[model samples]
Target: MSPPRRSELEMRKELVRLRMEMQRQQLDYHAEPLRHPLRQLGHLFAPGRAARGKGTPLAFGGVLLLTLFGKRLGRFGKLARFALEVYPLVSAGLRQYRESRPPKPPQAPPKPQA
Candidate 1:
């Protein structure tokens, strides 16, 4: 047989490197400990997607309708004023709820010798 094509040789080398890299990554991931602080920090700032069945077509349609006829559907400047008033109250309620919650109790130590 003639010498192997240059493209074929390069392809085989890349495939071997990818397989080795994937195994190394998998081992590193499995050896690491799971930490919750990073996850909690992320959750604090992100808005999660709504649960299934909660985002119905009618809700989307209502948002579309509000956007399409935004000014004509409401009294002059009332909708903007209402949004301004409601957002702060909702934020305050959430803050108070988080602050007033009790701290987690400590875990018991292992039993001592008899």
Candidate 2:
């Protein structure tokens, strides 16, 4: 006998329901212990918190997410910087290439709506 496997749709619905439950729990997120790393971040950024501006607890949760996932963010930062440096050259080359192309014939104007 083998364990039952769930369909992709069943797994997806379960994931969505779990996420919604988590979101509802997060509405009272900051009232949890400040000593915890995530709640400590909540203290750091929640508006009227003195350390940072008055931000809604739910909105400020992103800061806690960054705290929890900092290594991944640091890796992404390097990629972002390289992309930023390349963006200007890519855009300028694209602009010049487009400018060199022959213009298209103008389309007939649409008849006025009734």
Candidate 3:
């Protein structure tokens, strides 16, 4: 196969430069929303709608299986009880995350003295 010509290399470099400039412009355009006074103020308010009754079908099926097998196997009852105990922990972590402050950029690491 023939080697690429000098013009082809120049064209490729120009294409890459154009692509990078387009990305930079797009980022700046999208970032304008965060700079808006209304958007900054609105972020302070609580988010709308608490998540509830949003269980998957698998969860419902597990509950049904537990209820059905609880009498015959007894293990199902224990499994159900364990799940009940863990539910509060899962919800508490979720609630804490929902109410937590926005993440900040990481600070530079401290330089070691010579």
Candidate 4:
């Protein structure tokens, strides 16, 4: 006799269980440093890839640093947002200024050769 097929609910439950298992494994891997005293130093020197996404290391570091220091640097976020808001206006004014400037007089052509 053929085995009974799983119901949709059963499949979803199995998926949830698998996801929980994967998350536990990831947590265990990331927390491994706490198991050994020197491992934390190694972690600092050679950061683990377990928590990294597919993004470049620079992007990941930016995201990590931002999350870590964002509250302390909240003023900078406001400053950055203000700069972004003003950039187009400033650039447009600069462009207009450049465009409105009179062209420099052209140098007279070199005297024709004898």
Candidate 5:
């Protein structure tokens, strides 16, 4: 066949663009259900947020365990409760200890002077 005309080429380009836009809309439709769950998972595992400080991850894990295994935990449930109760005190003691320590002296610049 002879080379295609300009109008035909433009029509083909427009068709391809429309098809791509449709596919993108389809993708968003299918992914909508997973968006909220994936967002929650992302927040749970986000950098710096997951382990914001000492006992943070542990507290989260403990709560998760208690939520997921409350009945099965039996005697361990009491221990978990005790630990949860004392976590704040331990955290406070740690914070006080860190505050009481001497601050480190600033280091000189590593670059050589001109």
Candidate 6:
């Protein structure tokens, strides 16, 4: 077979480029309907957008409560009793630690320039 001319190679390249572009456009068109839903799903699962320091602890406590109470009430009662018993000692230790820390020196006012 004869070697292909430069013009023929260029034409083939242009045809491939146009075909690829058309396929890309078609893919975009077909995916248009999914864009919004996919975006919403992304936002729903995005860690950065999740609520921070808000009801997170409360939600966790709620789940914990449900799990504790769902299976057995005695376990929850025991946990509560343990927490109550430890509260006073924990508070006393914290109070002693705070009292032992040295107080910060007060800042002096800036001197006025002549």
**Clash count per candidate:** 0, 3, 0, 0, 0, 0
**For residues 5-103, what per-residue lDDT tens digits would candidate 5 score against the true structure?**
679889999999999999999989756545655563455557664354444767878756765565578899878978876776777778889999999
- Runs of candidate 3 with Cα error greater than 4 angstroms are 1-53, 84-89, 104-114
Output the lDDT of residue 31, model 5: 62
Instruction: Specify the highest-TM-score model's number.
Output: 5
Best prediction by lDDT: 5
How do the residues 13-94 of candidate 6 rate in per-residue lDDT, one tens digit apiece? 9999999999999989756545655563464336653432122454445435543453355777567646644554666678
Clashing pairs in 2: 47-53, 47-54, 47-55
TM-score of 2: 0.32
Which regions of candidate 5 deviate over 4 angstroms?
1-55, 103-114
Tell how far residue 59 is off in model 3, in angstroms.
Answer: 1.4
The local lDDT score (0 to 100) that residue 36 gets in candidate 6 is 56
lDDT string for model 3 (1-114, tens) is 999667988999999999999999998875665467466335323253124324445554654565445446577678785884466467667868877968788999999999
Q: Cα deviation of 112 in candidate 3 (Å)?
A: 20
Candidates, ranked, TM-score: 5, 3, 4, 2, 6, 1
| Model 5: colliding residue pairs | none
Each model's Cα RMSD? 22.3, 18.1, 27.3, 14.1, 18.3, 21.2
Candidate 4 TM-score, C-alpha based = 0.34
What is the Å distance of residue 59 in model 1 from its true position? 39
In candidate 3, position 11 carries an lDDT of: 93
On lDDT, the stronger of 2 and 5 is: 5
Clashing pairs in 1: none
Order of the predicted models by lDDT, top scorer first: 5, 3, 2, 4, 6, 1
Each model's C-alpha lDDT?
0.57, 0.62, 0.63, 0.61, 0.72, 0.60
